[model samples]
Target: MKILIVDDEVDILTLFKDVLESVGHEVDIAIDGESGLKKFRNKKYDVIVMDYRMHGKNGIDVAEEMLKMDRNTKIIFASADSSIKEKALEMGAVGFLLKPFDIDQIIKEVEKIEKN
Candidate 1:
């Protein structure tokens, strides 16, 4: 699947990119919400994995913005902040993954989405 990963942390982006790539998924990345939204508008992705807290727009903001363009767009919210899960759900995220998660969990979540 073509995946878009948006996060403020460079290491997180690289880690996810490596893991997803190792599993044979095409991936794109955005360092912040503004850039993420820009890239999002310019391309199409099967799934979007985003961080909840970011420098500019934040994940919830990005998700809400994306929903305006495509309500059915599959989204996964990844964050260190626990409270964002409820907000993510309200914003139409399909799944939520907290930071420091096992790679298998990430893969499982993506697989679950693919199955649906």
Candidate 2:
């Protein structure tokens, strides 16, 4: 699957890109919500994994806009904050994986998407 990962931290972006690519998925990275939204509009991706606490726009806003553009757009939010899971789903995220999750969890989530 083609996946977009958005995070303010460069290391996290690289890590997710590397991990996802290793699993044979095309991966794209954005440093902020604006860039993420721009890329979202410009590309077709199977999934979007975004950070909830970004400096501008935030993941919720980004996902909300993406949903408006394509309601079927699948989104997964990655954050250390557990409290945002409910909000993330309300904003249209199909999954909420907390930061520091194992690669297996990511794979499982993607598998769940594939099932649907």
Candidate 3:
């Protein structure tokens, strides 16, 4: 699977990249929404794991823009804020992972989307 992960925190980006790659999935990292969108425009990903809150554009903004470009793109919104899950889904996110989620959880979510 190919995945794009967008997060402002370096640690989170590193951890997710390591975990997802270890499972034999191709992974790309973007530190902010602008960079994420740039990368998204350049390549195709099976799934996008994005942080809900970021510096320039939030996860919702990025997801919305991506959906505008391709409504079939699958997005998984990951955040510490549980309150945004509903909003994220309403904006077309396929999944939501609360921050501090484990590798298993992430993998499960990705696999679920893959199967669908």
Candidate 4:
């Protein structure tokens, strides 16, 4: 699957990108929501993994605009805050992973979306 990972932290972005790429997926990383959205507009991604907290445009804002353009893309949010879980889903996120989620979790989530 082609996946886009958006996070302010470079470590998380690299880690997720490496792991996902190693498993035969094409993954791209963006340091912020708007950059991620720019890439999103240029490519066709099966899954998008985003961080809730970002510098300029938060994940919520980015995901909202993204869904408006292509609602079929699976958006999986990974955040430390559980408080926004409901809000994320209500906004059209397909899955939410709390911060510190394992690599397997993301893979499974992507695979689940891929199957559909």
Clashing residue pairs in candidate 3 are none
lDDT of 3 by residue, 6-61 (tens): 99999999999999899889999999999999999999999999998899999899
TM-score of each: 0.96, 0.94, 0.97, 0.96
- Point out the worst 10-residue segment of candidate 4 by lDDT: 101-110
Q: What's the true lDDT of residue 64 in model 4?
A: 95
Q: Which stretches of candidate 4 lie over 4 Å from their true place?
A: none
Worst 10 residues of 3 by lDDT: 98-107
lDDT of 2 by residue, 1-116 (tens): 99999899999899888887888889999999999999999999999988988988888888899899999999989999899899998777999998888877887787788778
Clash statistics: count for each candidate: 0, 0, 0, 0
Candidate 2 clashing pairs, residues 3+ apart or interchain: none
Q: Positional deviation of 68 in candidate 1, in angstroms?
A: 0.6
The most accurate candidate by lDDT is 3
TM-score of candidate 4 against the unseen true structure? 0.96
lDDT tens digits, residues 1-116, model 1? 98999999999999999998899889999999999999989998899998988997888989999989988899998898988899898779999998878878777878888888
lDDT of 2: 0.89
What is each predicted model's overall lDDT from 0 to 1? 0.90, 0.89, 0.94, 0.92
